[model samples]
Target: MRPNLLKRAHSHNKQTLNNLLHSRGTSPHPQPETISGHKQIEEETLPKYNPDHWYPVRLGEVLHHRYEIVVKLGFGMTATVWLARDLQADGNAGNRKYVTVKINVNTLGEEFQKGRREIAQKLFSANPKHPGYSHVRFMLDTFKVKGKHGDHLCIVYDVLREPIDLCMEKFPGRRFSCPKLRILLPALLQGLDYMHSECHVVHTDLKADNIMMGLGDPNILDHFVQNQIDHPAPRKAPDGHGRVIYTSCSDFGEPPNEAVIASAKITDIGLAAWGDEKNTKPIQSNAFMAPEVILQAGWSYPADIWNLGVMLWDLFEHFGLFDRIDTKPGHYHPEQHLGLMIALMGPPPKDFLKRCAKASIYFDSDGQFKHPEYIEDHTFESSIVRLKGEEKEMFIDFAKKMIAWVPEERWTAKQLLEHPFLTKEKEFFSATPSLSRASTASISSMIPSRAVTPGIPPSSSPNSGPNSSPKSVPNTTLLPPRLLELVPSVSSTECESSTNCEETKTEKLATNNEKSTSRTSLSLRPKMESLVESNNEPDVEVPNSKRLSVNKANKCSQDIIDAILSKGKNHNHRVSPEAK
Candidate 1:
């Protein structure tokens, strides 16, 4: 019932259809007071309201003499979702269970309704033993409500908290943090595998919006219903309209934790189709359409993979993968989209062009884009700047396997499960230097095993040994920014206490801090010189590959030492007392 909750719900509820050619109307209209004396506020588009279009419902109204409407959750073009309590359930007001009731528009064709029912039946009949079975959401119950214009089909579902995108907004950049991404990707892939392999369903629409974050505590819904009863939702009777438009309240209780995030499920299968079928009607949101979908060629499960690829970019980068608009605003065209694809991945292959039914429209005889001017100079390497080193490499490799020009080239959901990016047991680090156990493992993997020995002094150092040079420490750009920020400034008093006045040893400390969720430790030792010398051991011969690996580790370790020295230099601390 909070204003921000209502605003976020309003933005999410009014889901629009993004396709090839259609656009919705958003003409300004006058705001007047409702019969309840409240200001006329908009929920869904007022123009969309009609007897045959959007079905009208009132708050506190009991549908089917069982489910009591509690609050509006969200609305799409075809249906409006509401939070309702099943009267048949056992508990009292504070303990009763709640379900989401999706009231379909009266105008949703009979075929659309039938398709949903069939998919639900198939999903229920499918194998439940699969790990992904629980990750994908299905209908709990289905019923009907006769309206003034026509009978509205109502489907019941387990109440989910909110969309994944809204949940990701809690992080720093309105994107999923590395830790959350690790939890999200595998679950999504499993769900996709189950939907494709077991259920034979292709979720044509796969995006952040379609994925709903699952509820953690069962009591959250009960709390929500109790709050609604205590503080009734905003009701507005439109001027001369017969029904009151209740503003949707989507907040379940509090912000979700890691468990709630991990429980996220793939939802909204209205556009889902059987993978075995060759039904080739254009599928997927315009920005996420696969090459096959855009070319008007036949598509199947692989198209979903392509959709996932684009959706990943949106999730991580906080932007769409392509620019679909032409010179005019709100005008999205396939030509422009294809042009951008060319810029990113180069022109479609000759074999791929031959397979496209509409290839001639966008591509020349030699498979070049017809509108070269529309192609922006962009590449995957240039776009993904948030990640670096192994993380960036693995991500790009994982994404390239899915966003291939040819649908067949895209890896299947099951195959993608084993991708190094997903399967690699790497724990993503945060902006903070307080490394988790998982973070330690990830960093250890980055450093070569032979190159590092914790708590042990190096045999010799290239700089500090018997033969050493008195040169200023080189620049330190290699250390990660987060790690570099932790380097303490070397004060003159602190330097005076050092055993070796020529060099400052990065003090190592271990603390049993119960306040942090994970272990907080920072070890910045200048052991890179010893690592370099060890690699050049005269009697011990090593492989060229091993040498390269050790050199890489040396460089990485050297960065930390340089960063520590640089901090000392900036503070004007003397490396040794030999010179004033």
Candidate 2:
């Protein structure tokens, strides 16, 4: 087992609450070791674990004059979120206010555009007047600048302190309380309602991390300067001669002070979208997605409502409702990913399967979701992440309403706010200290936290779970980071060669090379095409929208129409089935 690769594997797995709850106590199982980086030492004399290669790009390095980068707040697949200061907050709310900047070098491709439409289109509440539309900005005022490569997009936003997840982590002693949940949820519901009614939007990625607190009434220019700062140029330090003194150390000086957005507005436009492919396919955080989303049924605000329910649950219960999904394929059947729903709402409605495009992998006959090849189960019994008391019941009730297999069955965000659980929060938000988040002592302690597949396996037991063991894939070699932008992914690899022969071709889809299954392309039957089909087909003329072309052909109105026909209502939705 090469220690460096092992650490990375461990870090990626940390996103799962199960790993956070119980993965540290287990012994390090030996792996197929490889040679890289430093020389191998005796097993008894391994060096300390290092977190070098992947450090957050100090906020200053990415942006220019407006704010300073304090520290990394969090990160996702394409971008890293930062907490920084805005120099123009007081006199120029028009300029620099504290902001959260999402820095992504990745091109965003289809995912970014889908999210843009979701939030730009509607709010994620049940009520016609969810407050989100009233306050949140659909598009982030942003700009772009040069990086080590050439260009990168920096999405500027009104900064907020801790995310809801961090807040829950800080508050350990309190039970998922009624008063607190009430105070918080209504504001959330109102915001969602506003977005839905005013913008016709839906935030498909509704997780604690995405919901923020800051921005009462954001000044209009809040987004304007953000655009400029994104691509700030490196300034030359006065060498007593007005000459620039370039150094390897920090670039942007006095980056803004990172803070909880004194008030937060809806952020992450890349995750919000307008159309409904059915609530079935959302590019959502695994822990918060609705069952309809998992089952491939039509979904819309209800999916966000389910996410809100989890947020409501987080107010009292520190634990996310469905944080224990097995990561490996063939562990349980795909249906089992709906464990929280099954546990709270009972068996799915009979038509649930009919709406689904059967899973590519499962743990057993019951059809629970199996882990993907890149993930592994490294849970340890001794490490326990606990959330007890009334909070548990509150979460269960919320989960029931949010994850019903039937889209219609799930509660709307507005409906959720009206529940007895959070009645008092109707008046203006009872401002809470975003900075106070949970107690540090409680958060500091927790159990810790994958890989390519060798083969696809089926389960013998209907009650089984995804294989917990790890497996290796063919290509683990690290390539130059530049490939992310310069090289076209996959198939282009063949074109890179000077020989340019048909041999050594790079395949595009799995079917091009292997008989393997993707989560979106699982046990598909011909009739299942309904999952991707749409009732109303647009004119033959193609609509012009593509952040990145899946291929000019895939962008044709007919192709999108076909996917809808095959996948059902959710096909046109911003949340693609291939959402990470």
Candidate 3:
């Protein structure tokens, strides 16, 4: 084995072992039992492997007699993504490029055509000059493969590294830093703007799972292919299903610090529809769904804004903005969902409700919500506890513009790009200079005037120092709050600037350096405590003057909310945090 590969494997194993033994009795759930003569591990559901469903994909199998499958990247409900090498490219093996091939399920042959056409037209025909055009994932090529069950559509795309949510795991907490969000949020909005304005498309499903990070270094792909060549992915021998099921092994390795928030592209336009396409079909995940969608009112680009707003909590706060605990298991409760919405956004507007098809069912003639008990007494400002001071204020202001109860009230993607959260760059003080002071001089005087590392202005500063501290920040994203807490206090040192020295007093923070789990647990305690306190605080009732025509939508009898709101199939195959 190559020395670097061996070292990486050793380090990975060490980390795995360490995580396994992290908290003794508190170790993660055991893996599923292996079948006889085979490792029983988590992969695609065995039941899905049928003659008329999944296309039996094999490693090294060349599709269309041109692209050779290298390894399984990921598997989803309707398709499987694989890394493939172009056999006809004009280069040697080492110099040739790779592309991701998404083979759709046989069952989706007819249903996926509209989406496929829109994806191709919107991405390819979009104005190249539109700033968001580049941020949106576009198709390189498309074709069809005839399988034994039926025909399957094959889509070829540029090999993006991983999804935004997966990238968040590299940080101490699974969240992006403010600076990183400042960089990535605009790119996402720009992409949305391009889809909405230039392409006349509305991404019905806009969440972390659909947003992927652009590949930064070409060498990462080379290493992945080399790793596969050295150690082939393990596969289950043909059993009752009579098809080999190979475990996915698509890892681009830990992204270089600069790659964190380098660029985020909106992928998976499979569920997207044209903005002018008038359809009230239920869209967006339950928690992120807009009120207009749940109420069966007409929706358009604003729905995406609402989806993005709710998703922001997941990205920055490490939790869903709306609570989703219903009596039914793996089902959506519309009443419960609406109650949460009412709490954050206050009651929906009476005028808007009048236009809703099912408004009467949820609300009385007077516009009072029928199930007022389900409502949680909270506001957007109170629900957000992680951020504080001006940062918190700016975030709430930005969110309010997107999550308005009325869809028309929501800001357009282009207008949102100019918000303070996206426009104003957050500034941070540089790491303190570790200098040895002479005599008993002030520690502040010993250190040079702290330099201001400006929040990245455009994509020009790729090699900036602040942008290179992924380990210290949230995946080259944000400065780890834990590290900021550890900044030592120097007595009597007059700081040149208040930003550098405001938090000089020693804080009574407990730290555990023994194990990662311990550190994670200890570090999260304060945040959780703060969250609990915020929840327990006295509920400030929304005054009658401010409350909208107070009403609730009656719960739909059928469970329409998609099951497993947070569940996602990742292209990059790393040990998930839950598995660890």
Pairs that collide in candidate 1 are: none
Query: Please, what are the lDDT tens digits per residue for candidate 2 over residues 255-295?
Result: 11112221344555565666433234545666565666666
User: What lDDT is reached at residue 459 by model 2?
Assistant: 29
Pick the TM-score winner: 3
Tens digit of per-residue lDDT, candidate 3, span 340-381: 778877788788898788878778888888889879865776
Q: Candidate 3: list runs displaced more than 4 Å.
A: 1-43, 46-51, 92-96, 256-260, 326-330, 427-580
Show the lowest summed lDDT stretch of 10 residues, model 2: 525-534
lDDT of 1 by residue, 123-188 (tens): 877899997888899888888998777889999998887787776766556776444665687778
Most accurate candidate by lDDT: 1
Angstrom error at residue 50, model 2: 17
Pick by TM-score: 1 or 2, better one: 1
Error of 3 at 536 (Å): 13
Error of 1 at 276 (Å): 1.3
TM-score of each: 0.67, 0.47, 0.68
Q: What is the lDDT of residue 462 in candidate 1?
A: 18
Distance from true location, Cα of 484 in model 3, Å = 30
Ranking by lDDT: 1, 3, 2
